[model samples]
Target: MQNGSSLSIAERGCFHTDKFDDDGKIKRTGTWKSATAHIITAVIGSGVLSLSWCFAQLGWIAGTVTLVLFSIITMFNTILLTDCYRSPDPVTGTRNYTYMDAVKSNLGTFQYKLCGIAQYGVLTGITIGYTTTTAISMAAIKKSNCFHKHGHNADCHAHNNSFMLIFAIIQIILSQLPNFHKLSLLSAVAAIMSFTYSFIGIGLSTAKIIGEGIGNTSLTGIPIGKDFTGMEKMWKTFSALGDIAFAYSFCFILIEIQDTLKSSPPENKQMKIATATGIMASTVFYMLCGVLGYAAFGNDAPGNFLTGFGFYDPFWLIDIANICIVVHLLGAYQVLSQPFFGFVETWSKEKWPQNKLVTREFSMWGFDVNMLRFVSRTTYVIVTTIIAMIFPFFNEFVGLLGAGTFWPLSVYFPIEMYISQAKIRKYSFTWIWMQILSVACLMVSLVAAVGSTHGLITSLQKFKPFQSVS
Candidate 1:
C-alpha cells in the first residue's frame, strides 16, 4: 500500500474502507494548507484581544515567557495526539475518525465516552461563546459609530440581541453546508480576517506608542500603587495566566482537523507540521499584539485593545478591525462546532439506521440535504444564539473552559494515549518524565482554574444579564 492506498482483507474491508477512505465516506481533500487555515481560524480568536491585559498583569518577562511556553506545550501535545490519528499503525492502520475514536482505540471504550463529554462540552461552550463574541464585536462597531456621531460623553448603548439575531440567521444558512471538507474557503477567509484584525491591532498599538511616548511600565508588571493594591496584583497575575491559556485552545479539535487531511504524506506527519506552523504564526501575532499594546498603555491597558476605546481617533480603522472580528468568529464558530455536529449526527445514525430522517440525504437544488442535520443544526444554532442573548459573558467562561480542559485534553490525555499507543515500559525514565510533565501541567491548570473562577466571580458581582456595555 502506498500513498492514498486503502487495502484490507475481505473480512476487514467493510470496517477499513468501502473503496478509498475509511468507512466509505467522501474524499478527504484537506491539505496541510487548509488544515493550517482551520487551525488559525480556531486558535487566533477573540482570546488574542485580551493578551495585552495579560501582559500588563504578568509584565515583560513572565508575559512573553508564558506565551512562548504555552505555544511549546500546545505544539508538543498536539503532535502526540496527531500521531494517534490512526490505530495499530501510525500511518496506515484503520482510521480513528474522531477524538473519541482515538481515545477508544488507545485508551478504552469507557474513556471514549468521557472524552466525548469533555470534547463536545468544550466545543459547545466555544460555539456559544463565539456567538456572543461576534455579537459583541458587531455591537462594538455600532457603539463606535454612535459615539463618533454623538459625543463620546453622550449615552450610546447598542443593543446586542438584534446583532446576535443577525449572526444566528447567517449561521443558520451556513450551517446547511455538509461538513469541514466544504469549509476550506470559509476557513481561509476567516484566517485572513484574523490576520487582518491582528495586524490592525498591532499597527494601532505601534502608532499610539509613536505618537505618545511609552507609558509607565515595570519589568515585573504593574507595581503596587494607590489604585492597585498588592493583593489585587497577585490575583491579576494568576488571572493573566488563565487568559494566556485561553489564547491557545485549539486542542479540542486537533484530531478532527487531522481526520480531514489526505492519507498521502501521512496525516500524522502533516498534522504535526501544521500544528507547528500554526502555533508559530499565532505566537508571533500574540507577541506583537500583547507587547505593542502593553508598550502603548502599560499598566492601564484595556482588556480589549480594539473595542475598549484604545484608539478612538482612527474610527474607520477600528470599525474595520471589529468587522474583521465578526467575520473571523463566523468561521470560527463553524470550525469549532462542526466536530460536535459530526459527533451527534454520527451517533444518531448508529442508533436509527432505518430512519430516513436520521440517515438519508436527498439532493436539493445544488446541495445535498439531510433532514436530521438541517433540523438539529438549525435548532443548535438557535439555542446557542438565545443563550448568548441572555447571558452573553464570553471571555471569563472561555478562559474557564481553557483552564479546566487544558490539562485533560491538551496535556494529560494526549500524553497518556501516547504512552499506551507507543507501549512505553512502566517506570521507565521516559514514562516517568512524561508523567511528571502531566502532573506539572495539572498543577498549572489548577492555578489557572482558580484564576478563571475568581475572574468570573468578580464579573458576575457586577451582574446584569442581557445588558450591553460599551
Candidate 2:
C-alpha cells in the first residue's frame, strides 16, 4: 500500500507535514480507546433517546430486529469504508483523508460533489437536532423546577427558541475548537454522557415497571394488524427503520475518525476493533433504553425518553440527565459540524487561492482567531438554531434527516464504493446480497423520508415561532 511518500514534494508541502512523525507516518494522536469513545459519541446521539418512541411505532419485536440489523449493516459498511481509505494508487499508491476524497477516488468527481452535499446536509440536520434537543431538555428542566417551586398555576413555560439561541451562542465558543483530534476529549465526555443518560433512563424505566407493575406497562411485544391498516403499519415500520438507520448513521465520518488514528497498517485493524466495540456497546445501550422505555410507557411513549415521562418524580435525576444531554450535544454539534467547516474552508481556498479572506487571522485578547471560521461556523449554527426553533419536534425531524440521507450515505454509497473498488461481479453472491440490501434500505428510507416530510409539514402548519411548544 502506498503511503504519504506517494505525494509530490509540493503536494506534500501543502499537506500538514507537522502531522507526520520522523518515521514518516501520520502521527497517531487518537487511539482505539479514543476512537471507540468518539464512535459511541457519534452514534448514540439524541436518536437513541427516541428509540423507545420508535419501538412504540414498530412494536418491541420489529424494533429490536431493526436495531440489530442496522447494527450489523453499519459495521459492515464501516469496514468497507476503512478498506476504501487505502486504495492502491497506480502512481502514488492510495490515500483518502475524508469521505469526499474517498468518493472522488472510487466513484467520480460528480459523485464526490453529490456525496459532499448529502454529507454536509445530513451533518447540518444533525447539528439542528442537537440544538433542538438541548433546548427542549433545558425547557423541560426549567418547567419542572418551576412547577416544583410554584403551584400548578405557575407560568412555567419557557420559549424553546430562546434556549436554542442561547445554545447557539454557546456553540460560537465550542465550535472554535479547531479540528476532530482536538475534539476527542470532548467526544470522550460526550460518550460518557451518552452512557450516563442511557443508564439513568433504563434505571427509571425498570423502577417504573417494578413499582407500577407490568399491567400498567405498554407491553405490546409485537405489532397488531387491527391497530392500523397494513399500509399504515408498514409505513410506521419503515419509519422506525429509518430511525434505527439514522441512529447508526456515522459512516460518513468513519474515515475521518480513522485518519486520526496512528498511521500504520494496524490502524485499519484498530478501526475495525473500535467499530465493533462501539457498535456493540451502542446497540446494547439502545436495546436496553428502547425496550425498557417501551415497557414502561408502552404505546404512550414519547419520542424522547427523557421528555416522555413527566419531570415530576426524581426531579433531580431528571435535571442531571438533561444537563448531561445538553452538554453532550454541545460536543456532538461540533463533531458533526467540523466536517462541514472543513469542506467550506477547502472550497474557499480552492475557489480563490489568493483570497486572504479564507485564511486571514486576527488577534483577539492576545489570541489569534480565524475570521472565516468564526463567521461561517457561527452562521451555520445560527441557521440551524433557527430551523430547530421553527420545528421543535425532535423525533420527526431526526427521522426526516435519517430517511433522507441515511440510504445514500450510509448504505448505497459505501456498498457501491466497495463493489467498485473490489471489482465484485454483478451476479456474485456477495454483490447480489449487498445490492439487495442496498435496494431494500433505499426503498425503506424513501418511504420514511416521505412520511417524515409529511409529518414535518403538518407540524409547520401548526407551528408558532418563538412560542413554547410541548
- Stretches of candidate 1 off by over 4 Å are 1-19
Scored by TM-score, the top model is 1
* TM-scores, all models, native as reference: 0.94, 0.91
Candidate models: Cα lDDT each: 0.84, 0.79
> Highest lDDT: which candidate?
1
Off by over 4 Å in 2: 1-26, 89-93, 151-155, 215-235
lDDT of 2 by residue, 339-364 (tens): 88887876776676666666666788
lDDT of 1 by residue, 178-296 (tens): 77888899999999999999999999888889999787777998898899899888777777787788789888788889989988788998998899899999999999999999999
Q: After superposition, how far is residue 24 of candidate 2 from its true place, in Å?
A: 7.8
The alpha-carbon lDDT assigned to residue 90 of candidate 2 equals 17
